[model samples]
Target: MEIPIYIFYALLSAIFAALVAIFGKIGLEGIDSTLATTIRAFIMFVFLLLVSAFQGKLKGGITSRQFAFIVLSGVAGALSWLFYFLALKTGTVKAVVAIDRTSVVFAIAFAWLLLGEEVTLRAFIGALLIVIGAILVSLK
Candidate 1:
Protein backbone atom coordinates (compact mmCIF):
# COMPACT_ATOMS: atom_id res chain seq x y z
CA MET A 1 0.00 0.00 0.00
CA GLU A 2 1.15 3.46 -0.90
CA ILE A 3 0.68 6.49 1.30
CA PRO A 4 -0.16 9.85 -0.21
CA ILE A 5 2.59 12.48 -0.42
CA TYR A 6 0.55 14.97 1.59
CA ILE A 7 0.53 12.61 4.59
CA PHE A 8 4.30 12.63 4.64
CA TYR A 9 4.40 16.43 4.45
CA ALA A 10 1.78 16.69 7.17
CA LEU A 11 3.80 14.41 9.43
CA LEU A 12 6.90 16.54 8.91
CA SER A 13 4.87 19.67 9.63
CA ALA A 14 3.62 18.15 12.90
CA ILE A 15 7.14 17.32 14.00
CA PHE A 16 8.39 20.82 13.27
CA ALA A 17 5.37 22.34 14.98
CA ALA A 18 6.08 20.37 18.15
CA LEU A 19 9.66 21.58 18.08
CA VAL A 20 8.40 25.15 17.67
CA ALA A 21 6.55 24.92 20.98
CA ILE A 22 9.58 23.65 22.83
CA PHE A 23 12.04 26.03 21.25
CA GLY A 24 9.72 29.00 21.47
CA LYS A 25 9.14 28.38 25.16
CA ILE A 26 12.87 28.30 25.88
CA GLY A 27 13.59 31.30 23.71
CA LEU A 28 10.84 33.36 25.26
CA GLU A 29 12.30 33.10 28.77
CA GLY A 30 14.24 36.38 28.72
CA ILE A 31 12.65 38.24 25.84
CA ASP A 32 9.23 39.76 25.45
CA SER A 33 6.85 37.37 23.74
CA THR A 34 6.00 39.91 21.06
CA LEU A 35 9.67 40.54 20.30
CA ALA A 36 10.44 36.85 20.21
CA THR A 37 7.55 36.29 17.85
CA THR A 38 8.67 39.13 15.60
CA ILE A 39 12.18 37.71 15.38
CA ARG A 40 10.82 34.27 14.61
CA ALA A 41 8.61 35.68 11.87
CA PHE A 42 11.56 37.48 10.30
CA ILE A 43 13.60 34.31 10.31
CA MET A 44 10.74 32.42 8.73
CA PHE A 45 10.29 35.11 6.09
CA VAL A 46 13.93 35.07 5.10
CA PHE A 47 14.10 31.29 5.09
CA LEU A 48 10.96 30.99 2.99
CA LEU A 49 12.14 33.71 0.64
CA LEU A 50 15.34 31.80 0.00
CA VAL A 51 13.48 28.54 -0.46
CA SER A 52 11.02 30.07 -2.90
CA ALA A 53 13.79 31.72 -4.85
CA PHE A 54 15.73 28.47 -5.03
CA GLN A 55 12.64 26.58 -6.11
CA GLY A 56 11.89 29.18 -8.80
CA LYS A 57 8.51 29.78 -7.20
CA LEU A 58 9.05 33.53 -6.94
CA LYS A 59 8.35 34.13 -10.61
CA GLY A 60 4.65 33.46 -10.50
CA GLY A 61 2.28 36.38 -11.00
CA ILE A 62 -0.49 36.43 -8.43
CA THR A 63 -3.88 37.94 -9.20
CA SER A 64 -5.00 40.94 -7.15
CA ARG A 65 -7.69 38.87 -5.41
CA GLN A 66 -5.16 36.19 -4.61
CA PHE A 67 -2.72 38.80 -3.31
CA ALA A 68 -5.40 40.33 -1.11
CA PHE A 69 -6.30 36.97 0.40
CA ILE A 70 -2.65 36.13 0.93
CA VAL A 71 -2.17 39.42 2.78
CA LEU A 72 -5.17 38.65 4.97
CA SER A 73 -3.80 35.21 5.68
CA GLY A 74 -0.46 36.70 6.66
CA VAL A 75 -2.16 39.05 9.12
CA ALA A 76 -4.11 36.17 10.60
CA GLY A 77 -0.96 34.09 10.86
CA ALA A 78 0.89 36.94 12.58
CA LEU A 79 -1.86 37.26 15.17
CA SER A 80 -1.81 33.52 15.71
CA TRP A 81 1.94 33.53 16.34
CA LEU A 82 1.70 36.52 18.66
CA PHE A 83 -0.90 34.79 20.81
CA TYR A 84 0.80 31.40 20.62
CA PHE A 85 4.18 32.75 21.68
CA LEU A 86 2.60 34.70 24.53
CA ALA A 87 0.78 31.58 25.67
CA LEU A 88 3.95 29.51 25.47
CA LYS A 89 5.84 32.10 27.44
CA THR A 90 3.32 32.10 30.29
CA GLY A 91 1.87 28.58 30.24
CA THR A 92 3.11 25.00 30.27
CA VAL A 93 4.01 23.77 26.81
CA LYS A 94 1.84 20.71 27.22
CA ALA A 95 -1.21 22.78 28.03
CA VAL A 96 -0.43 25.50 25.54
CA VAL A 97 0.14 23.09 22.68
CA ALA A 98 -2.92 21.12 23.57
CA ILE A 99 -5.09 24.19 23.24
CA ASP A 100 -3.25 25.41 20.16
CA ARG A 101 -3.86 22.12 18.40
CA THR A 102 -7.55 22.88 18.56
CA SER A 103 -6.87 25.12 15.57
CA VAL A 104 -7.57 21.95 13.60
CA VAL A 105 -11.19 22.12 14.71
CA PHE A 106 -11.31 25.81 13.84
CA ALA A 107 -9.93 25.08 10.41
CA ILE A 108 -12.56 22.44 9.84
CA ALA A 109 -15.35 24.78 10.82
CA PHE A 110 -13.95 27.60 8.70
CA ALA A 111 -13.59 25.34 5.71
CA TRP A 112 -17.17 24.20 6.00
CA LEU A 113 -18.53 27.67 6.65
CA LEU A 114 -16.42 29.84 4.35
CA LEU A 115 -15.23 27.47 1.66
CA GLY A 116 -18.35 25.39 1.24
CA GLU A 117 -16.39 22.26 2.05
CA GLU A 118 -18.41 19.25 3.10
CA VAL A 119 -17.75 18.06 6.64
CA THR A 120 -18.13 14.32 6.53
CA LEU A 121 -19.53 12.52 9.56
CA ARG A 122 -16.18 10.88 10.19
CA ALA A 123 -14.32 14.18 9.96
CA PHE A 124 -16.82 15.89 12.26
CA ILE A 125 -16.47 13.10 14.82
CA GLY A 126 -12.69 13.30 14.58
CA ALA A 127 -12.77 17.06 15.16
CA LEU A 128 -15.02 16.58 18.20
CA LEU A 129 -12.60 14.01 19.57
CA ILE A 130 -9.72 16.43 19.07
CA VAL A 131 -11.53 19.16 21.00
CA ILE A 132 -12.28 16.75 23.84
CA GLY A 133 -8.69 15.53 23.90
CA ALA A 134 -7.33 19.08 23.90
CA ILE A 135 -9.54 20.01 26.82
CA LEU A 136 -8.46 16.93 28.72
CA VAL A 137 -4.80 17.54 28.07
CA SER A 138 -5.02 21.22 28.98
CA LEU A 139 -6.68 20.61 32.33
CA LYS A 140 -4.80 21.50 35.47
Candidate 2:
Protein backbone atom coordinates (compact mmCIF):
# COMPACT_ATOMS: atom_id res chain seq x y z
CA MET A 1 0.00 0.00 0.00
CA GLU A 2 1.26 3.38 -0.91
CA ILE A 3 1.39 6.01 1.79
CA PRO A 4 -0.11 9.43 1.14
CA ILE A 5 2.01 12.40 0.09
CA TYR A 6 0.84 14.25 3.18
CA ILE A 7 2.56 11.62 5.33
CA PHE A 8 5.86 12.40 3.70
CA TYR A 9 5.33 16.10 4.19
CA ALA A 10 4.44 15.52 7.82
CA LEU A 11 7.57 13.46 8.32
CA LEU A 12 9.66 16.21 6.81
CA SER A 13 7.91 18.73 9.03
CA ALA A 14 8.78 16.69 12.11
CA ILE A 15 12.41 16.45 11.08
CA PHE A 16 12.60 20.20 10.45
CA ALA A 17 10.82 20.88 13.72
CA ALA A 18 13.57 19.05 15.59
CA LEU A 19 16.19 20.98 13.67
CA VAL A 20 14.37 24.24 14.46
CA ALA A 21 14.69 23.65 18.18
CA ILE A 22 18.40 22.93 17.99
CA PHE A 23 19.12 25.79 15.64
CA GLY A 24 16.88 28.22 17.47
CA LYS A 25 18.48 27.36 20.80
CA ILE A 26 21.97 27.96 19.46
CA GLY A 27 21.05 31.09 17.56
CA LEU A 28 19.13 32.52 20.48
CA GLU A 29 22.11 32.62 22.84
CA GLY A 30 22.28 36.42 22.99
CA ILE A 31 19.19 37.42 21.05
CA ASP A 32 15.68 38.33 22.08
CA SER A 33 13.20 35.54 21.45
CA THR A 34 10.77 37.88 19.71
CA LEU A 35 13.49 39.16 17.38
CA ALA A 36 14.63 35.64 16.65
CA THR A 37 11.05 34.66 15.89
CA THR A 38 10.68 37.68 13.60
CA ILE A 39 13.83 36.83 11.69
CA ARG A 40 12.75 33.21 11.36
CA ALA A 41 9.29 34.28 10.21
CA PHE A 42 10.78 36.58 7.60
CA ILE A 43 12.97 33.80 6.26
CA MET A 44 10.01 31.45 6.16
CA PHE A 45 7.92 34.08 4.36
CA VAL A 46 10.55 34.50 1.66
CA PHE A 47 11.07 30.77 1.25
CA LEU A 48 7.35 30.08 1.02
CA LEU A 49 6.88 32.94 -1.43
CA LEU A 50 9.57 31.48 -3.64
CA VAL A 51 8.00 28.04 -3.49
CA SER A 52 4.53 29.40 -4.22
CA ALA A 53 5.78 31.46 -7.10
CA PHE A 54 7.74 28.56 -8.52
CA GLN A 55 4.63 26.38 -8.38
CA GLY A 56 2.43 29.12 -9.90
CA LYS A 57 0.26 29.06 -6.80
CA LEU A 58 0.38 32.73 -6.01
CA LYS A 59 -3.07 33.67 -7.28
CA GLY A 60 -5.00 35.98 -4.99
CA GLY A 61 -8.60 34.86 -5.30
CA ILE A 62 -9.47 33.77 -1.82
CA THR A 63 -12.89 34.60 -0.37
CA SER A 64 -13.24 37.07 2.44
CA ARG A 65 -13.98 34.25 4.88
CA GLN A 66 -10.91 32.41 3.69
CA PHE A 67 -8.79 35.51 4.07
CA ALA A 68 -10.10 36.10 7.58
CA PHE A 69 -9.40 32.54 8.66
CA ILE A 70 -5.95 32.62 7.13
CA VAL A 71 -5.19 35.83 8.98
CA LEU A 72 -6.45 34.30 12.23
CA SER A 73 -4.34 31.21 11.68
CA GLY A 74 -1.28 33.35 11.05
CA VAL A 75 -1.82 35.33 14.21
CA ALA A 76 -2.37 32.19 16.25
CA GLY A 77 0.75 30.62 14.79
CA ALA A 78 2.78 33.73 15.57
CA LEU A 79 1.58 33.70 19.19
CA SER A 80 2.35 30.00 19.49
CA TRP A 81 5.88 30.53 18.18
CA LEU A 82 6.42 33.48 20.49
CA PHE A 83 5.46 31.45 23.54
CA TYR A 84 7.35 28.40 22.32
CA PHE A 85 10.53 30.39 21.88
CA LEU A 86 10.09 31.94 25.28
CA ALA A 87 9.75 28.48 26.80
CA LEU A 88 12.70 27.11 24.87
CA LYS A 89 14.86 29.97 26.02
CA THR A 90 14.53 28.80 29.62
CA GLY A 91 13.69 25.10 29.37
CA THR A 92 15.50 22.00 28.18
CA VAL A 93 14.76 21.13 24.57
CA LYS A 94 13.51 17.64 25.34
CA ALA A 95 11.01 18.77 27.93
CA VAL A 96 9.94 21.80 25.93
CA VAL A 97 9.36 19.74 22.78
CA ALA A 98 7.56 17.05 24.71
CA ILE A 99 5.20 19.58 26.24
CA ASP A 100 4.69 21.24 22.89
CA ARG A 101 3.73 17.93 21.35
CA THR A 102 0.80 17.85 23.76
CA SER A 103 -0.76 20.22 21.25
CA VAL A 104 -1.91 17.01 19.59
CA VAL A 105 -4.14 16.24 22.52
CA PHE A 106 -5.37 19.80 22.56
CA ALA A 107 -6.09 19.58 18.85
CA ILE A 108 -8.14 16.47 19.34
CA ALA A 109 -10.21 18.10 22.03
CA PHE A 110 -10.63 21.31 20.10
CA ALA A 111 -11.60 19.46 16.95
CA TRP A 112 -14.29 17.63 18.80
CA LEU A 113 -15.59 20.75 20.50
CA LEU A 114 -15.20 23.32 17.75
CA LEU A 115 -15.16 21.32 14.54
CA GLY A 116 -17.70 18.71 15.54
CA GLU A 117 -15.16 15.98 14.76
CA GLU A 118 -15.65 12.47 16.04
CA VAL A 119 -13.71 11.46 19.11
CA THR A 120 -13.57 7.73 19.20
CA LEU A 121 -12.64 5.65 22.21
CA ARG A 122 -9.29 4.69 20.72
CA ALA A 123 -8.45 8.28 19.90
CA PHE A 124 -9.42 9.36 23.37
CA ILE A 125 -7.22 6.69 24.87
CA GLY A 126 -4.33 7.68 22.66
CA ALA A 127 -4.76 11.30 23.57
CA LEU A 128 -4.85 10.33 27.22
CA LEU A 129 -1.58 8.48 26.81
CA ILE A 130 -0.05 11.51 25.17
CA VAL A 131 -1.19 13.64 28.06
CA ILE A 132 0.40 11.23 30.50
CA GLY A 133 3.64 11.11 28.55
CA ALA A 134 3.81 14.88 28.29
CA ILE A 135 3.23 15.25 31.99
CA LEU A 136 5.88 12.68 32.81
CA VAL A 137 8.42 14.33 30.56
CA SER A 138 7.66 17.79 31.86
CA LEU A 139 8.27 16.93 35.50
CA LYS A 140 11.53 18.22 36.91
Candidate 3:
Protein backbone atom coordinates (compact mmCIF):
# COMPACT_ATOMS: atom_id res chain seq x y z
CA MET A 1 0.00 0.00 0.00
CA GLU A 2 1.22 3.46 -0.94
CA ILE A 3 1.39 5.97 1.85
CA PRO A 4 0.05 9.44 1.23
CA ILE A 5 2.47 12.23 0.32
CA TYR A 6 1.16 14.23 3.27
CA ILE A 7 2.43 11.54 5.64
CA PHE A 8 5.96 12.20 4.48
CA TYR A 9 5.49 15.93 4.92
CA ALA A 10 4.05 15.37 8.37
CA LEU A 11 7.06 13.29 9.36
CA LEU A 12 9.37 16.01 8.12
CA SER A 13 7.42 18.54 10.13
CA ALA A 14 7.84 16.44 13.27
CA ILE A 15 11.56 16.11 12.69
CA PHE A 16 11.99 19.82 12.10
CA ALA A 17 9.85 20.64 15.12
CA ALA A 18 12.13 18.59 17.34
CA LEU A 19 15.10 20.43 15.90
CA VAL A 20 13.36 23.75 16.61
CA ALA A 21 13.23 22.99 20.31
CA ILE A 22 16.86 21.94 20.50
CA PHE A 23 18.15 24.78 18.40
CA GLY A 24 15.89 27.37 19.93
CA LYS A 25 16.94 26.35 23.42
CA ILE A 26 20.56 26.84 22.56
CA GLY A 27 19.86 30.08 20.72
CA LEU A 28 17.77 31.55 23.54
CA GLU A 29 20.60 31.83 26.02
CA GLY A 30 20.98 35.48 27.15
CA ILE A 31 18.34 36.56 24.64
CA ASP A 32 14.80 37.76 25.14
CA SER A 33 12.25 35.15 24.20
CA THR A 34 10.28 37.64 22.12
CA LEU A 35 13.38 38.72 20.30
CA ALA A 36 14.36 35.16 19.56
CA THR A 37 10.87 34.44 18.27
CA THR A 38 10.96 37.50 16.05
CA ILE A 39 14.28 36.48 14.61
CA ARG A 40 12.99 32.99 13.91
CA ALA A 41 9.85 34.36 12.31
CA PHE A 42 11.89 36.66 10.10
CA ILE A 43 14.05 33.77 8.99
CA MET A 44 10.96 31.69 8.24
CA PHE A 45 9.40 34.54 6.26
CA VAL A 46 12.48 35.00 4.12
CA PHE A 47 12.86 31.26 3.49
CA LEU A 48 9.19 30.91 2.58
CA LEU A 49 9.36 33.88 0.27
CA LEU A 50 12.41 32.49 -1.47
CA VAL A 51 10.79 29.09 -1.87
CA SER A 52 7.57 30.61 -3.20
CA ALA A 53 9.45 32.80 -5.64
CA PHE A 54 11.61 29.93 -6.82
CA GLN A 55 8.51 27.81 -7.42
CA GLY A 56 6.64 30.68 -9.15
CA LYS A 57 3.85 30.25 -6.64
CA LEU A 58 3.69 33.88 -5.48
CA LYS A 59 1.39 35.28 -8.13
CA GLY A 60 -1.89 34.07 -6.82
CA GLY A 61 -4.34 36.57 -5.33
CA ILE A 62 -6.20 35.85 -2.15
CA THR A 63 -9.70 36.91 -1.16
CA SER A 64 -10.10 39.26 1.78
CA ARG A 65 -11.52 36.43 3.84
CA GLN A 66 -8.55 34.28 3.02
CA PHE A 67 -6.18 37.10 3.92
CA ALA A 68 -7.99 37.69 7.19
CA PHE A 69 -7.89 34.05 8.21
CA ILE A 70 -4.25 33.72 7.20
CA VAL A 71 -3.32 36.74 9.25
CA LEU A 72 -5.25 35.37 12.20
CA SER A 73 -3.43 32.09 11.87
CA GLY A 74 -0.10 33.88 11.76
CA VAL A 75 -0.91 35.80 14.89
CA ALA A 76 -2.00 32.65 16.68
CA GLY A 77 1.17 30.89 15.59
CA ALA A 78 3.32 33.78 16.77
CA LEU A 79 1.62 33.77 20.16
CA SER A 80 2.13 30.03 20.46
CA TRP A 81 5.81 30.37 19.66
CA LEU A 82 6.26 33.25 22.05
CA PHE A 83 4.83 31.26 24.93
CA TYR A 84 6.68 28.13 23.87
CA PHE A 85 10.00 29.94 23.92
CA LEU A 86 9.17 31.49 27.27
CA ALA A 87 8.43 28.04 28.63
CA LEU A 88 11.59 26.61 27.13
CA LYS A 89 13.64 29.37 28.70
CA THR A 90 12.65 28.19 32.16
CA GLY A 91 11.77 24.51 31.71
CA THR A 92 13.20 21.30 30.33
CA VAL A 93 12.63 20.86 26.60
CA LYS A 94 11.19 17.39 27.04
CA ALA A 95 8.48 18.50 29.48
CA VAL A 96 7.80 21.75 27.67
CA VAL A 97 7.37 20.03 24.31
CA ALA A 98 5.24 17.27 25.76
CA ILE A 99 2.90 19.84 27.32
CA ASP A 100 2.87 21.97 24.21
CA ARG A 101 1.86 18.94 22.15
CA THR A 102 -1.38 18.80 24.07
CA SER A 103 -2.32 21.42 21.50
CA VAL A 104 -3.28 18.40 19.41
CA VAL A 105 -6.11 17.74 21.81
CA PHE A 106 -7.17 21.37 21.54
CA ALA A 107 -6.96 21.09 17.76
CA ILE A 108 -9.17 18.03 17.78
CA ALA A 109 -11.77 19.74 19.90
CA PHE A 110 -11.59 22.94 17.88
CA ALA A 111 -11.91 21.08 14.60
CA TRP A 112 -14.96 19.29 15.82
CA LEU A 113 -16.56 22.42 17.24
CA LEU A 114 -15.51 25.05 14.75
CA LEU A 115 -15.11 23.09 11.54
CA GLY A 116 -17.94 20.73 12.26
CA GLU A 117 -15.65 17.79 11.67
CA GLU A 118 -16.65 14.39 12.88
CA VAL A 119 -14.80 13.07 15.92
CA THR A 120 -14.80 9.33 16.15
CA LEU A 121 -14.77 7.51 19.45
CA ARG A 122 -11.33 6.19 18.63
CA ALA A 123 -10.01 9.69 18.03
CA PHE A 124 -11.39 10.83 21.35
CA ILE A 125 -9.73 7.91 23.04
CA GLY A 126 -6.45 8.72 21.34
CA ALA A 127 -6.69 12.32 22.42
CA LEU A 128 -7.31 11.17 25.94
CA LEU A 129 -4.24 8.98 25.81
CA ILE A 130 -2.16 11.88 24.55
CA VAL A 131 -3.33 14.00 27.46
CA ILE A 132 -2.38 11.26 29.87
CA GLY A 133 0.99 10.77 28.27
CA ALA A 134 1.73 14.46 28.23
CA ILE A 135 0.89 14.70 31.90
CA LEU A 136 3.08 11.74 32.70
CA VAL A 137 6.01 13.14 30.77
CA SER A 138 5.58 16.60 32.18
CA LEU A 139 5.77 15.45 35.76
CA LYS A 140 9.25 15.54 37.23
TM-score of each: 0.97, 0.95, 0.98
Q: Which 10 successive residues of model 3 have the least lDDT summed? A: 88-97
- List lDDT for all candidates, in order: 0.97, 0.93, 0.97
- Residue pairs clashing in model 1 are none
Candidate 3 lDDT by residue in tens digits, 55-124? 9999999999999999999999999999999999999999999999999999999999999999999999
> For residue 59, what is the lDDT in candidate 1?
91
RMSD to the true structure for each prediction, in A, is: 0.7, 1.0, 0.6
| Worst window of 10 by summed lDDT in candidate 2 | 55-64
TM-score result, candidate 3: 0.98
Q: Give the lDDT of residue 124 in candidate 1.
A: 95
The runs of at least 3 residues in candidate 3 whose Cα sits more than 4 Å from the true structure, single-residue gaps closed, are none
Which regions of candidate 1 are displaced past 4 Å?
Answer: none
Q: Name the runs in model 2 displaced over 4 angstroms.
A: none
lDDT of 2: 0.93
